[model samples]
Target: MSANIILFHSVLGLREHERHLAGKLGAAGHAVSLPDLYAGVATDDLEQGFAIKARIGWEVICQRARDALASTPGDTVLAGISMGAGVVASVWALRPLTAKVLLLHGLATVPANIRPGLPVQLHVADTDPFFPEPDVRAWQHAAEAAQTDVRIFRYPNSGHYFSDPALPDYNDTAAALLWQRVLAFLD
Candidate 1:
């Protein structure tokens, strides 16, 4: 079946990390659209990228996310990497219930206003410095409490950004498996 997928990138913007994933998903027959949240922000340095992410802020990210959803098919699936995941969750929290959310490397802050039961999948490194097991457990609990069918995958030795080939944290094995799982999720 053909699916419509709305993919968001990490703070690094649209790069190889997700381009390949998008192509794979697209090739698999899913209509994928990746939005550039960092419209005015550009960074050649990793530190600058981090700073830019902090400066761009989540509100802007969420706005771009909403725009992405609006432009995509009505039944588009929300997919994002790291900070992008936060954007997806933000949309989901705001009653964008039509789109299912796929979170790669992070989770959202749950509240009662948002409805539960949205299908959510998370892919994180087991040793991910940013999202440790304890914190991920908390996130899992929140999603579960919301009755969301949350699927979490852990890569044993991969770093926080295991899916990004440009980063030192990249793990080929993890990246490959991640896409395989992601493709299945998209289907």
Candidate 2:
């Protein structure tokens, strides 16, 4: 059940939490590529994180992910957090052979070329300020239209970055549950 996975970091940049998640996945026997889309800068401040994210942009992040995927196996599962989820949604169309997609804290539009029954798992807060209802619905509709086997888990009353321990928004219960379900998905 081992897999080759490329996990993209969130706008906060690549930090210990991401590496912790990668360790969890690796412990489960999956080979992981935890890429730092921000190169090396990571912050705990929300405003600074946003500024950094805007500077790096999604296109640049997608290119970095694409370059990482180019060297991995064809069926490498693509996983990401927040902004990273958007990266998966952006490039998955170019990787039709991807084994699956795992998203955290955000949702992305299903590309036109995605095949039916492609497995996708998403974990997010019930109502994330960063992820609006309209966008979530749109992404859901697109996934359904494409017939992707999509599973969405919503953490009730949780904060946007509920899974990050370093963030004030962290919820222990939500984070544990997320990992439980994510591990199941990985299996």
- Choose the strongest candidate by TM-score: 2
Per-residue error for 85 in candidate 1, Å, reads 0.9
Candidate 2 segments exceeding 4 Å error: none
Each model's TM-score?
0.89, 0.95
Candidate 1 lDDT by residue in tens digits, 38-118: 885554356777788788787877887787677666667877788777777687655545446778877666556544666
Error of 2 at 126 (Å): 0.5
- On the 0 to 100 scale, the lDDT of residue 179 in model 1 is 82
RMSD of 2: 1.2
Overlapping backbone residue pairs in candidate 2 total 0
**In model 1, where is the ten-residue run with the lowest total lDDT?**
92-101
The top-ranked prediction according to lDDT is 2
Poorest 10 consecutive residues by lDDT, candidate 2:
130-139
